[model samples]
Target: MEEKLKKIQQDFLNKTKDTKTLAQLDELFIALFGKNGQLDELSKQFKDVPKDELKKVGPLFNQIKQQLEISINEKRGTIRKQIYQSLQNEKFEIPSERTGRKEKKGHLHPVTQFEEDIVKLFEKLGFVQTDAPQIDTDYNNFEVLNIPENHPARDLWDTFYIDTTNYKLQTNKLLLRTHTSNAQIRILKNNKPPIRVMTLGRCFRYENADARHEHTFEQFEIVYVDKDVSMTHLQYLSEYFFKSILGKGIQARLRPKYYPFVEPGVGVDASCAFCKGKGCKVCAGTGWLELAGAGMIHPGVLTRGGIDPDQYSGIAWGVGIERMTMLKYGIEDLRSLKSGDLKFLGRF
Candidate 1:
């Protein structure tokens, strides 16, 4: 087994030496480390060794595995350096703007435009814009927000776990945040009461995509904590937001729902803008479109945030920017907001 490992190591080393472009390195990486690759196939043979022999083989196997990974990384760095050094020898010219000046107006992406409008509206309501990490620790994203590991509620979000092998000495479980609410714990722990902060950014979910869904999407969430905060405030904010965006006639209703992080959770739904509360495909024939999830912050969650639940109450809610944009523009397909086609984007 040791001899075979040494042979494999030498072979990969030689291939690494021959590898040039980053593309070639990527393909080589798959051959060596990807699923069902050379190393994986070899590791399967470990069980064949006697237990006494297995103990000796295991350590050597690990040592070679790490060495190969380091070698690959070093080769990648050398290639990148060569590319940058080559750029230094190359020359380029920028065309004079005055010589071929033509007016070319670029349109803001539909999602960005919608997000900006929401931000401005929140600013009026004393909500300061804040930013949070798109990639965050699991403790912040789920456990601290009242969704602990193995909780059925965790199934509500299909989270993307980070590949930590490349991250040096990382101990904490990390993931691509499934919701902007990942910022909720951060906001509460860092800020004192009367905190009205909103965060807007990209969220990732490992889920199938269709016309109305995306694997990656934009989300905006507000974390509000203050003395005597109540469900009334949540309702008011929802109604005010819907009326402002969809005209004063638009009505928003709250229905009892279950969200692990909040007490008395409610789903905020709005009368269908397309069918005027009548059944339609856009509303899934429900006469209302689900817009946001919200509720009074659970006492346990507040305690974890270093806040005395007895003194301060809180509310948290999040909205999908793409969905709101769709409602505002009478867009039928959520996919269109992200589609790069000029003909579709030019309209907005």
Candidate 2:
């Protein structure tokens, strides 16, 4: 057994010197030290050997393994350095043959470009950018927004409910917020009025995804509350936003719409950019596209936020960022905004 172990050690030490690459070293390791390998089989044979020879065999086997490991690691380091050097010395070579002109660089993603443009426009209007947690309590997302638990607006169950094992209630009540408007409520509660805030973020819903609808989407909310604010202020801001986003040729119209948090809500519509309000496939031949939902703050919402409705008024508007992005860029599908495909995104 001692003679066999000596022969094995000599063979390994002599053979490994020829290993020029890490892969060759790896093969040697597996052949000798790996499971079901030569070294493992030798160790297993110890049970059949005389008891007095067991101690010597175990230590010899360990010494061989340790030496092999040291050599393998050292060779691996050298091989890695050589490979890195080769890579560093490599160069890109252009073809010698003539080629056609490459295509022009693609445009920005419509959503990202439009989002920046709108945020810049609103910044100029003195609306500071604000954000809220995507995961929110029912109070901040609902009750504080004047959509109490049992309100008809709660029927808007399209929201994503989060596991609330951590909450005191220990119920499935926390959620992925459904709209950026929830930020308005948060702003009101944390900051005293004379607040003009805008939020941009993702909102999740349980709705079916389509060309015009996405289960996850983006919306921007503009909330302004101060002394004696009115519908005229809301209209002016709405018109300015539409004109800024869609260009001077476009016009915006406000039509009555209802929302739980806003009294006498209005749907802000912009004249279709495509066909310029005459009629087109972009606007579904309506000559108008619903752009945003906006209205004056309801008294209940004001009271809930510690603001006196009689003493202060606020305007809140929720704009579908995807919708606006699609309109400005003539994008037909809302899903395009969410899809990360470079082919679709690069056309912005």
Candidate 3:
């Protein structure tokens, strides 16, 4: 039994010294120290040995196990050091230092470009550009706009409300403005009539995004307030702006619709340029693409804005900037605008 133990020790030492990698070291450990391995079989044989000899065999087995563990750890460290040194000796070219290729110049985002173009077009029509807060009071966002608490039109906007119990306007709710139309009442409250204001900004809604919709999106609204403002002016403005942005020969029509803030609202639709109003998938086979909502400002809304609706009538229209971008660029998915995909955006 003593001679057999000496043979096992010598064989383990010989195999471990020849191990060149961690994999081989692991295999050696399993063969000698694992369950049902050589060491386990040898330990079992101790039961058959005389009790006086058992003490001598037990100490020798422990000594071999400890030495094997120390040797494996030292070998693993040496292998790691050698591998790291080999990697350090390898040559690699730094990307920024490479020559002969022109650096790509960055450009404005497609949405910003669209906004600028739209602003320019509206400016030419005597509309003054303005902006509004993304976070606004519930009064300006809903109440001031004639959207009462129980009104069904309130359901149209999936609002993101903020806790205002600690705020100065504790009695009022705070929320992400659902539309740029909120700017209309705000502008009217601050400025008197004969206002030709065009506002473009981001709006939010608690909505699931799809090809045509997004929770966060850009909206553009133009509000014109003056005596004798009528549906005729609304139609003319919509057609002119649509033609200016969508290019020549485009036709726009207004179909009767309803909005709480806008009395006798009309749905604005433009003939699909893709199929020339003959009907196609781009227009969902309707031949006319629904564009925006426009109407004379409601008396209740005007009264909330401190304007005399009986003497002064106003026209206002709100359009989705992303929707316009989709039509202008022929993009199928609204998600592409907010995707952060350089390849998709670079096309514009």
Candidate 4:
């Protein structure tokens, strides 16, 4: 088995060397890894190996599979680069005019690019990206985060709920998440203290579409927990994010606000880059544009998350991705980010 594995590995590597186009590479990939393919057939023969040789066979086969996967990925990158470069000098028929010059295939969407930059920024501060269900239980989305039934904060979100009649569950038991804050309770409940995690994804709230708001949007939130956590840490994170993304000249400030999951919540603002902190119409003469909301986690939320409220504290900071991207790129309408206009997307 070991000898056959080594032989197949060598043969496949040689076969891959002969491929050029992505389509060819993809076909080669399936020939070796697909159902009833070389690797798959070999895997089905594991039982035929003697018990004494089985351990050796498993490890060798796994190592060779990993090596092959890595080689194919490297080749895939090379071929993609070649295609992109070659297309630069090639021309194709355009859909409208019936003829046009060659164009680069595509790019990461502006929102995706911006999200990646923010993820990198937070990773430097020991925060790793994590996820929660976009369709989550009301318990996790609201109750666990301390916004219980009839709470004034519940009115803040115009939620879209899932009907449970067919599922035999209670009404409003499951729904599209309104914000990324649903990740906080899961992170806290599942991980030990000194946790630093961020989540970025689609969040929905029923709204009348306009320049300033949308029914569906992206949200980015970070949940931090540990000893000595306080407002100062939250402030530092806000300032660090705005400065790193908006430029070092911009400044951040906090105004007292209210949130059920947090104590002494504050509305976060950054000095208007357009006015350089001087009053302007863009900032509504305030010289500060409201950006995010953050605060030290409330003891009730900490207790609910199974953390000892007396021993540890936390911070929850969240911002709208569209809003941040708009601010950074000087985009006027929130709807434009999702308009799917080639002229707008091509600009990036």
Q: Which candidate is the best by TM-score?
A: 2
- Model 1 TM-score on a 0 to 1 scale: 0.69
- lDDT for model 3 comes to 0.84
In candidate 4, which residue pairs clash? none
Q: Name the lDDT value of residue 126 in candidate 2.
A: 86
Can you tell me which runs of candidate 1 are displaced by over 4 Å? 1-104, 152-157
Off by over 4 Å in 4: 1-99, 153-157, 170-172, 274-287
lDDT of 2 by residue, 48-87 (tens): 8888887777788788778877877777788889899999
Q: After best superposition, candidate 2 residue 286: deviation in angstroms?
A: 2.5
Question: Weakest 10 consecutive residues, lDDT, candidate 3?
Answer: 94-103
Give a tens-digit lDDT track for model 3, residues 65-154. 788778777887888888899899999875654776656678888789999998998888788988899998777788877778987545
Q: Point out where model 2 deviates above 4 Å.
A: 1-108, 148-152, 163-172, 278-284
Candidate 3 Cα errors over 4 Å, as ranges? 1-100, 165-169, 275-282
Residue 336 displacement in candidate 1 (angstroms):
0.8
What Cα-based lDDT does every candidate model obtain?
0.87, 0.82, 0.84, 0.87
**Best first by TM-score, ranked:** 2, 1, 4, 3
- Candidate 3 backbone clash number: 0
**Cα RMSD to native, each candidate?**
18.6, 6.6, 7.5, 19.1
Estimate, for each residue in 1-348, the C-alpha lDDT of model 4 and write its tens digit.
888999999998987888898999999899999999899999999988898899889989999999998989899999999989999989875574455655568898989999999999999999989999999988888998788799754564588888777776555488889889888888888889999999999999988987668999999999999999998899889988998998887788899998888998999988876677787665778877788989999998889889998999999999988878877887767789999997898887
As for model 4, its CA RMSD to the true structure in angstroms is 19.1
